[model samples]
Target: MKLAASRYPLRVATACALFGAIAVAQASVTQVSQITASHTVQQLAAAIDAQIAAPRFASSRWGIDVISLDTGRTLYAHDAGKLLQTASTAKLYTAALVLDTLGTDYRIPTQLLVTQPIVQGRLEGSLILRGMGDPTLDTPGTNTDWADQLAAQLAASGVHEVQGDLIADDSYFSGPSAGSGWEARDLQSWFAPPASALSVQENTVNLMVEPSRVPGERARLKLDPADAFPRVINTLTTSAGNTRSDINLYRAPGDMTLYAFGHIAAQSQAQTYKLAMADPAQFAGTLLQEALARHGIRLKGALRVLHWPQQADIGLDRAVVLAQVLSPPVMDVLTRGLKRSQNLYLQNLLQIAGVKARASAGQVADPASGFLTTEAWGIRALDELLGRIGIPPEDSQIEDGAGLSRQDLATPAAMTHLLVYLARQPYGAQLRDTLPTAGVDGTLQWRMRNTAASNNVHAKTGSMNDVRCVAGYVTTASGERLAFAIMLNNVVREGDEPSPSRTLDAIMEQLAAFQGRG
Candidate 1:
């Protein structure tokens, strides 16, 4: 049945205004307006099905699951059980599992330990910078100045000189440098940096390039956090006119050499790129060394990297702690991860979950031979947690904690089930609060604007090449809360042929305006 224009005047008008001429070409406004103010479970399902059946999505694989939060009844289901690539929406599972395994108030610690006591500010064996998988340590935008803070603490402790090496201890997490199934091209991008126990600034460095004042001259380069590592080879030439900026930056795997090539318009503004660090532990050590030098503290020995197992066997029980920095609580970290879909934070949380699960199971993690053991434990923990929550273990194809891996897969039904289960738990409210509100904040800020779903949907958005998804809660017009999941895969982007997002948004709007079983 086609929708009546008069019945949903606001939605029709908003849709037309938001989508402009494309709305008429892409959406069946007449068909949508035929939907009535009141709907039964069957009617709502039919309405959603009609929208998804639109010509734009005819070639795509689409799945959706909607269930009533109050009645625990399925309102609509369309291929909900079919597993598909979840993109960043997989962070939902990681977030919930971490919160369930590790309390919300838990904080990761980064500490400085001295191997030898300072006698009259002269003698010290070594200074160890130990990390407990704190992803937030020395973040770029955050107000935490841990490097300076550590230096200050050392100066206050009468430590003017270090007789030994400054060792970086990042043994908490053991696994492949990058997440499982991450594309090789993404390794150098900020979103897929190597997962290290002692990551700083998300294990990325920002490089800003400005066109030279004179045409034909090499463009100027600047690096934030100014370090000598990741040496930059600038071969850019400044050109005149409105030429396209073709600046390219490439970093070899397991190497610090950055090659910058191509041209920049002399009149163009500076461009900044965030490049992943090949060795985060060493990068952090270099930064700390510079910080210490600025504070007049001298280290006679070279900087070194050490694992925790090595430190443990040394039996330095009398080692003194110079300073320690604590990360923001787990809740804050979860919020940042969910709201912004941060891969680094979520991956660290997953590794932490793995560590905690191993500790709980009385299995001592052997850092030497336990490569990827923590990550394995984390994946198993998530599977076990899902089983306890009524989701079949096989429903989710878990890969890395962050959804950056192409191997990650989850069915709409599985994700919706997870959401429904979380809604009844004590942490459910907090979890809901972390999601992006439609048209209000986070990734959803610009989505569903000026529509019924605006400000009424709290959900997570996922996107990758040929994939788009959203899964979360929506408050209906009659004050009913519904948990919904929508996944679209193999979607082709061609010219102005209306994105699959439009269909998803239209379906959500209908769900928002639905008043079921009045």
Candidate 2:
């Protein structure tokens, strides 16, 4: 075969060499493009790190974790194992636990029971209002008309008068009125109302104040529901012109009096103040009485509260059901709790879960058994939920269902793990739909506007005096879904600069623009 080498063979060998060079150049270009893409992702990480490491966050503690949902890969992590105060972001765990345990269709029931049957338009025994910790009992501006419906039912049943007391059976939840570790100063504020098994209007009263018709006169005051326990003491004087309003409202701990002082400008708009009620059971009882009166149903006795301990020996077998109102489904409760960061809704959910857990285990009826309180049982249920999702017990420090307590803590890794686990469950889509979308709805409506993260990120935000956090899902530019959590504690605001939220927004925007290697 080596016998004849002609001019044509040399030309063929040269052509082969040219083709090999072209293949080598193409491979190099592909390698360079991959390297550039990797570098871009790295640059994004570096930029986020720099922002967190800036002077403003020098004295603060932060935990960040981001994972790709498509590949289960860690995109970035910084102190991901560190425990931090979660603020309201802790509601995510509560929402998920409730949704998983109770299911999205579960509904809390509020029932009307009569101890004796009605005869000749009169009931011989007491009428009981049994509450199973329904937080949506009496929401303002919404006409559930539960009371009206109950009245109608009573009329239809020929119950013209009740000979005994209107009793409230709020024994479903038992423990301290508020969560453990709650600040005493916040007791009278609308955000920290007492948790009752029977809650009405979120256990708060809305007070509206208007400037007097003339200067130097007292400001007029009005309360919504008109029957909340707090009495108003108005000492405000209206001033002339558009002077800056100096209205002040104060209510002492465990007090039923609201003091409104200082001056309100005549041209100023009417201001509304929400004050927490002391006894939610009594508040609910009063509302029901009023509602009954409106329905022409007369009660012969006063309102009273009956607890489970007192009725442990007396059975409810003789009670007859007159009417009942089922609360909105658990899905609505979870949505309101997560999107609006409502402490009352989450607290009630935890209580309901506790009751169900105890009842399921057959431990609620035994007085000799070392039964846990509502708060304690709720914590246990959440711990069990976390264990099922592969998160260790040491990763969380939950003292209450709501994050209003200072004792609540969670690691970023744990939060991201929860998000990842939730995304894979059967009810994951419903759970995700409850989150606040970036600059679109819920708590995130005013954040990340006009940016890459806008309308693309669905997250839960947490904030307190010195704590800020955000955790949820984000859809990247490359069509990859991601789970992320960022928590900053003990953050101090610097002079004239924006809050730590801006830094968080910057990090989220960067993540939104990320394009992983295709």
Candidate 3:
């Protein structure tokens, strides 16, 4: 990307610069699109060409790359140098940064601290539950929460009561409550939950919607934490008979007041929705207080969630570690982030990683949003990673880890560059195992099924309004491994032709079936 247009042909020079590291030009039709690599490579190119040339995507832009892992050759490419909207594919770079900076087995811990001695369950001035940004404090598939786990740990430590304020210290992360570049509409949704240092239940609250016993009655609303949201106005009612179930959730930025409306069918079973939390640390404190009572640890003081500049003066230098809970190994946690496209997980990871990089650089925060912003510092760190990976600074300009920011952009060549670099590392395969598998598991489970690529392709799938992308590894029929990236922007699925998603599947199908002699 540093090479200007006068020296490079639009996208060709940039892509070639990365691919050239392989010691061979891509399969050329004439050595420069003249002498092709082989009949199979030509066939593979033709199939992809057909997909890209489809009439439906005539107005869209594409960025693609298919490189053989067995041989560092670009088997197929089209506009691979273009910086297109990456959607969730941006998480790949975040995953790489995590592996490079913190190994796969690293664990994030949340600790319970008491600054004063608890003599005969007394003399405690204040108790602190400090969060170190472990997004998975509550293990998956368990009917438990982080507060419950840590509260139990505290009970195991012999302290039966807190003599003062129960503080949920979220000061570990130095930034505003929200992520940079997230829009107002996104903040109202669950996916844009705050990436706080002390987060629990992934910074989301689950609401159960069950139909009333009789028609025309208000539906039963059950909030899991019961106090996750400070207030809720539910206008949901059950329909008269068997019909569609429609439920809606809305909230204003920085407000914990939730608005729930719409009706469910009279006969429909209960449905649950995971909604965003306005204050994650507050939610954690509320839940912890309930857990403490359940564990017979009486809390004599009110619960509190302390953020930076709010409880910034809380003394913890000599705090005794009463109890703590560590998240699952980072690898396992990252698997859920990559596979489920969990926005908070990726954003939290980026935010916390930047916290470290900032500490290392002796910096605090950036005033990007007119206040302290850890996200900007995080972006700078990821940008440095891109530079270290040899990806051109011009090829990408990512603003957030979840790729939910409208300003996020990355090129297929850069995607493949990061993929290939990570693949060559000692923990390369471990990283690959985190991606969604084609037609087997994760986001790609329902895609490319019963085809050559089915169960054979392990990749990450990403999508947004007018955007779609799939990138990862696939095994060819000849037993060769290939890394690929297919990105589309401004896509509009219309007419009778297969949509871009199907076209991607079609392209992958041919790539899996290709028997290359090179």
lDDT of 3 by residue, 330-380 (tens): 888899899989988888888777777767666545333444456666777
Model 2: lDDT of residue 376? 75
Per-residue lDDT of 226-311 in model 2, one digit per residue for the tens?
87763777788898857877766666655666677778899688877676876677777777787889988999988987654455
**Which regions of candidate 2 deviate over 4 angstroms?**
1-40, 140-143, 214-216, 235-246, 262-268, 306-318, 363-371
Error of 1 at 113 (Å): 1.6
lDDT of 1 by residue, 110-206 (tens): 8788867688885458888877788878764552588888877888888889998888878777666677777776777767787888888778777
How many clashing pairs in candidate 3? 7
List per-prediction Cα lDDT, in the order shown. Answer: 0.79, 0.79, 0.77
- How many pairs of residues in model 1 come into backbone collision? 10
Looking at model 3, residue 355 earns an lDDT score of 70
Error of 3 at 87 (Å): 0.4
| Index of the highest-TM-score prediction | 1
Candidate 1 clashing pairs?
A: 2-31, 2-34, 3-31, 3-32, 3-33, 3-34, 3-35, 4-33, 4-34, 174-372
